[model samples]
Target: MVLRPHGGEKVRLMVVGRKRLPDAERHERHWGFVEAIADSAKDLEKGLRAQSYGTRTRGERTQPAARPAGEGVYAVTLEDGQMHLSFALELPAKPGEVQKAFRIAPEASYALSIKNPEKGKPVNAGLREEDEADYPRRLQEEFRGRRFAREDVRLLDFEGAEFILIGARSNPEAEYGLDLDTHDEDYQHAEVIRRLRMVKSRHPIKPLFEGRWA
Candidate 1:
C-alpha cells in the first residue's frame, strides 16, 4: 500500500476494484482507513507536543477533515489485493488560530510524521443520535455568539457524528466510517462543492481535488 500526503484537508485512500463490494461493506472499509489515519495522526501529534500540563500549553496538531475520494490530496489506491494510502497536513489558508500556534503569519506548513497499522483501522463509531443531538445549541453558549467560526467547524463535526452513529446502528455488519451516500447525495455533493469553491476562491490560491467521481 502507498501512503501519500495530499495537503491538509484529508488523507485519500483510493480503492480500485475488479468488482465493487456491497455498499455497506465498502463504506465500512473505507472509513476504517480514515479512522486509522486519523488515530495515528492524533497520537503522533500528542506524543510530539507533550501536553502534560493540558490546555493551550501544548501545540495543536489536530487532524484535518476526513473525506472519501477528493482531490489535490493524497490518494490511497486499492487494487489487486494491495492498498496505497496517502497522508498530508493541512492548515487554514490565512492568519488564524492555526497560524497563532505556528507563530508565523500562516506562511509555513509542516509535515506530520505518523505510523500505521498492518491490519485495518478502528473508528469512533460515535455516540447515538439521541446521545448528543442537543449539543449544537449548547455549544452556541461556548462560542458566545461567534457564529462564523462556530458554523464553520461545529456544524460539520456534529452533523457528521450524528450521521455516522445512525448508520452504525442500522447496519449490522458495519464499521464506523464515512459513507457520503448515507446522507443525501445531491446535497452532500453541493456541500463538498461549496467547500471546494471556498478553498479555490481564496486570493492567489490554486485549487486541489481528489475523488472527482466519488
Candidate 2:
C-alpha cells in the first residue's frame, strides 16, 4: 500500500520479505468475501437481518456464510465519535467442511492464548499486562506487553454496492511514525476511499468512487 502525505511525495510500503498467497487461495478468499457480502445483502433486502443466523425457506436451511478464518482488526470513525465494535462469531463445523487457514501480515498481539483461532472465535489474547491472568504459566514466566491491535470485518458501502473491508490497527505507517496525526476521526476511512481508485480496474466489485452511504 502506498501513502501520499500532505505533499505530492509518495511513500511506498516495503516489506522485508513479502509472501504472496497462492493463486488458488487468493481466488478463494476473494470469492469468499464477495459471497459473504452478497448473502448478507440478500437477507437484508428481505427485511431479515442476518448477523448471527440466517432466514431460511420451507425445506432449505440458510447457513451462515463462512468467512476467512482468524482475526481482523479495524479502526473506523462514526458521526459522534462513538466506538462501534462490531463482531460476528460463526461456528462452522460439519462432516465435510473446507478448513483453509491463511496467516497474513504480522499480527498485533505478542502472543495468543488460544493456540488455534481457525477453530473458533477470538479468545483472550494475552496481549495486555492484565491478560496475564488468563494463562497458567506463560504470564508467570514472560512479560506480555499491553499494546495490541483490535480488529473488525465491516461491510462498507462502496459506490452503490457493499464490500467486505478488513481493518486492523497495527498498520506499518502507524508503527513507523509516518502517519502519526491520528486524531482525525476519518483518517483511515478517507485513506481507504482514496486508494480504491487504484483497484477499480481489476477487483470484482469495481469500486468506482466514494459516495454517501445510502
Candidate 3:
C-alpha cells in the first residue's frame, strides 16, 4: 500500500496484491487506487468496505455476503465533503457477475499510509483524454445540486464500538464451507460487468491526478 496527498483535502492510496502459486510464472498480481478524503480513519475504513463489497446481500433470501480472496488493498476518497472509496477488479468479461472463487481468499493483508504527492508528477487514473478533460465538470455537477457541504454538518461522535478479527479454522473437521448455486451465472456476470463499467466510465479526476501543490 502507498499513500500520497491528493488535492487539498484528499489522499491517493494505491493497494497492490500478489497471489503466490507453486509455479513462479503462474503467480498473479492485482492493483487499484482509492482517492479518499483526508478525514477520520474510521470513515475511510467504512468507505473502503462499502465500495469493495457493495450492498451486503441481494435477493429475498439475504445470504451471507461474499468475501474477497487473495491479497487486497483499498483506500478512501472524499467527494462533496463526504468520503468515498472506489476500486476495480478484473473479472471474466461477463456483466454483473463476480465468480465465487474471486471473492474468497485463503490469506491476505493490507497496509495503510498517508504522504504528500511527489512534486511535478502526474498520476494516470486510466481515463481517456476526453473523459479526463470533463472530470472537473462532473465533480462540479456532483456538488452543485447539493444543498449543504458535508463539512458544514455536524453529527454526534460515538465511542466504545467493539471490533474483532477472526481467522478461519485450519483443521478440516472444524472448517465449514457453503456450496450453493442459486442464481443465473449469466445474469450475475452481466450485472457485475455493467456496474464495473459504469464506475470506470465515470472516470472522475482526483487531486492526485492533477499533481500536488508546490
Q: Which residues of candidate 3, in runs, are more than 4 Å off?
A: 1-25, 45-100, 108-214
lDDT of 3 by residue, 1-214 (tens): 2132222323222232332111112223233223333343323433333233335465244333212221112223333444322222222222122222233222222211111111111365332333221223433343345432222111101111111112222221222222211233332343322232323223221211121224
lDDT of 2 by residue, 75-157 (tens): 23331322222211111111012222222333211111111111222354212332121333432222223222122112121
Pairs with backbone N, CA or C atoms under 3 Å apart (clashes), candidate 2 = 72-151, 72-152, 73-151, 73-167, 73-168, 74-152, 74-167
Report residue 154 deviation for candidate 2 (angstroms): 34
Model 3 C-alpha lDDT versus the unseen true structure: 0.25
Top candidate when judged by TM-score against the true structure: 3
Q: Which runs in model 1 stand beyond 4 Å of their true positions?
A: 1-55, 60-125, 128-131, 134-197, 201-214
Model 1, residue 117: distance off in Å is 33
TM-score of each candidate?
0.19, 0.19, 0.20
Tens-place lDDT digits, model 1, residues 41-62: 2232222222334347665555
- lDDT of each model, Cα atoms only? 0.25, 0.23, 0.25
